[model samples]
Target: MCNLIGHALQQALTRRGFIAGSAVGASLIAPMMCSAVAGDDELDTRIEIAQSSGDTASSRTRLLLLGTAGGPTWWPNSDQCGISSAVAVGDAYYLVDCGEGVGKRLQQALLPANSRVMSANLRALFLTHLHSDHTVDYPNLLLFGLFTGLDRPASPLKVFGPGRRGQVAPVFSLPGSSSPTAPIISPDNPTPGTKDMTGYIYQAFATDLNDRMRDNGKRSLEALVEVHDIDIPQIAGFKSPNETPAPPMEPFRVFEDDRVRVSAILVAHAPVWPAFAYRFDSEDGSIVFSGDTARSENLIKLAKGADILVHEVIVTRWIHGLFPAPRSVAEEGLMQHLLGAHTPVEEVGGIAEAAGVKKLVLSHIVPGNATREQLSPAGKGFSGELVIGRDLMQIGTGQAAAPARKG
Candidate 1:
């Protein structure tokens, strides 16, 4: 049995193109060999033990959950806020989604407010999809950042998100008509891509932006913001506006700088085509954000061997309790839409397990006040460390210290 196991290990290393003489190859092979010999159950047990002991290596990257509520609305008395998060590497911060009140949350996180420090350090913004809940505070982030700190940003603020989806005909057209005469309508008109959307924001705030520039002697906010529309490479059953296919199952590098590299993959968020999950890789470690999705295999491929998986999770059973029983057809449809788009807590664990992430942090939590008993369903199959996210909670990328809970 020992000899057979050794043979299998040798074959696996060879298949992976690992050189026997290379120290890096040997380091990689050692873990695989142990896993193969101990088997999955033993390996999982070891992982659980290590997690329980808080065995995490120290690194420079940090994740802060600015808000953890699943939807756009924030309750008056609840501690939960709308969805937004920031991943900081060294002194630079990258924002993912800008839900309502994110600016205040940033202030609460000790990020410089109305200061030059904020302008210089708040590096870039990444939008997972164009949901209102994810983008409600975009204008605030863009405008507020200018005056909250010392001075306006010297460089253009970078924004990235998936390109617009192609227009589709309305479900209901004029009865007995072969073609609908009225122009095709969507949730938003012109199906503006991210670039266009950025421009529109600039135009919408032109008067105020100009006043800030001329009156306050500030830089042109319009000129200082640059937007990039991510043209999601087409995959089977996932079509982008361009209709061109990229290499299958490969992560697309969307942004890179001296501090970190950002890669994205198309995730399954049906009826909202071209939704993306982003992975940020820095010197400390890699962190992946699932934005909002439902059982996306591409996300698993993108997140393989990642240090932390910050995924959006919802408990469908609790969803009904949040709203009155679907009395109207529209209400029922809304519930169905919610059910179809978000990932269940249990499925979130399975995705983390499949990706082999070290820590699973659940954010954008549905029914914000979910109890431990309510969330236990997610732990049924996952053995890695699990963190129930809350607003202003800071998680270090490397060391497995207890998350610093603030606010």
Candidate 2:
């Protein structure tokens, strides 16, 4: 089953795709790839319906998992939504990583009866990186969200993400495969960060935005969103040597408000430079997000002593099966990047243990159909609680309020 699923997903992830090439459009073919290799339809239907397996607790600070699947593919046999999460403190909530399906998930997670808007209580949004899986629905958040009260916030909705990489990422080269000479996309500005990407999105939807503002009198999206590119602080040993750079560093402040103090540290997701792990400290407790990384000491440092650590996990067994033995040099190169950039389930527990976190919740899981036991290796070396995250699942990070007397 594992090999079948991995191979199904590999069809979505080409040996020369995503990691090595700047082919964001390649992800558009993911669903077709998944369908081409999808297994029994009846089995797929059963699992898809059974995956939403958790509920929330009443507390001042809570962690909500909006979606848990990783990668660009919409896995065929899975019910999980894309990778997104929220931290609710009192009445307002902060969001991290707006993946596909975020809108529907947010509505289920926060929208009240007779209410159509999900942004009324949303305080801010933070992006860990520019990966398509993480930011695919971002434009939807700003466009559709406007009708759902995104434009009604007392102040502009704050958004922050990595700044532009100084240069375009070099193409991949293996010993006996294709040349690294593929033509670049958007050559003039091959790599734009959060602020630039947001502007481009607005422009792409200018007709809709303009019509809404002129005909419907909706607030200008320009006036509703405030986007900022997070500036990286200097790191002593960091250098981009024909590759992306991530060096040892302190967690620098990225945002703050009366509810939470947010700090971030660079982690190793090479070729995807400026990837970050964020920590949110509130009066209730601390929660950290390991954006997408291999075992990172920088992440361990930032999450140290936190109440919860939400991290990404990929199945090593899946990788092994995804690329069977007797693979080509190019295949091996892609495999290596997949292994290096993502944390294996076996090692994730140790990362949580090293950070002294109270609990480790795994999200952004690859091969989204993986079962609980398949993901259980994440608890092998950790003493803390190990949670296999599910969409709509909620865990309290702060003290829960006492129940009102029934009488």
Candidate 3:
């Protein structure tokens, strides 16, 4: 249910996972789906929406839901953008994932307070996995941000994401049926991680990047952003990505600075090894992104005691409805695959409770058009506040940093 890519041969490989965001994907379930993803509800309880743009220009931290829709499918009639969120600590903000409409959403949500310049204060970007939805706009951010304010920052935007999946996932097969042949795409470097992906983008857009530098005197792409592949901890149970995507492990530090300390742990977004859940701890409080996972112990451990847990939730009922009863074995297998990778609305509450977070905000919502009634159950077991995430909504974390006192 957690949020939400593009084309070419490498794009074809990226789109290999369940994908959409096209005219065809928009009509994938045109019959049963209808409405926007804002969820049919007004603000209630701990939900914080910025009344004036000035509210977010603070020393305290805040969580901005830039694009809440999950999945590659572009749902019909839903204006919900793909899955992207930001943890803003004062002027500088860190981004988690780059789903569809991320650039535009960033403009709408952050530009006003940020001098209307893209990447003016974009401190960093952390990708949970290599899913098309999570990374579709990544290329755009690099390719486009340079023209905006990418080089305006004092330092490069440090990027972190999962490393390569050494082995390809096993193909699915129905009972008593032979496994289908799985063709490897780009076998020479079949599984590229964040660093490799960034490098490839540089190569793919070399002509354009060169034009900017040679013609307009812009800084090179490498000077604008620093990218890294998050190394998987070699845990005892972990064998290979296909064998065990995420094994029991402790949260490890990935990056840090004066403002926030970032830590990460492997979460189970199966077949996509080294999927991660990240935690950002600041003087204000802790905010954690569950990324896209199906209730993994590693995620729970990573999110323990966080102030705000921005977790992903799928409407389990909607998933079931996708493949109605009397489904063929292949249909049934597909249904199980969807269910296995995501946490359901009914289950996320318990996971949040287990993590002892003070507030649980659901994002990367599946079906984009899911109703509040269908999502309310997420609060049943959760003692903390529940926010049915909406695109561009703002929720402050911890106390708003006090204004400076006059002498």
TM-score of each: 0.76, 0.84, 0.84
| Candidate 1, pairs of clashing residues | 113-148, 114-147, 114-148, 114-149, 115-148, 115-149, 115-150, 116-150, 116-151
Whole-model lDDT, candidate 2? 0.78
Candidate 1 runs further than 4 Å off: 1-59, 112-116, 149-154, 168-188, 234-248, 322-327, 399-407
Which RMSD values do the candidates have, in order? 12.9, 9.5, 9.0
lDDT of 3 by residue, 1-407 (tens): 22110001122111211122233332332322233323333423323322222433343788877788999889776778899999888777899999998887676665433343667789899999999989999999888888767875468889999888877777777778876877888899988999999999999999999998989988898877989998765688877788878888889999898889999998878877778999999988999999999998989999999988999999998988889889887797677767999999999989998999987888998878777667877876887777677666566666656774448
How do the residues 1-407 of candidate 2 rate in per-residue lDDT, one tens digit apiece? 11111221232133221222223323433553454335555434322211121113446787877878999889877777899999988878899999888877777666543466678778789999999999999998889889887877467899989888867766667656556676788888888999999999989999999999999889988888999999887778777723436677899999999999999998898888789899999998999999999999999999999998999999999999999988776797789888989999999988998999987888999878776557767777887776667666567766654453446
Task: Please report, in order, the local distance difference test score of every candidate based on alpha carbons.
Answer: 0.68, 0.78, 0.77
Q: Considering lDDT, which of the candidate structures 2 and 3 is the better prediction for this target? A: 2
| Clash counts for the predictions, in order | 9, 0, 8
Residue 228 in candidate 1, Cα distance off native in Å: 0.6
- Best-to-worst ranking by lDDT: 2, 3, 1
For candidate 2, what's the RMSD?
Answer: 9.5
Output the lDDT of residue 60, model 2.
72
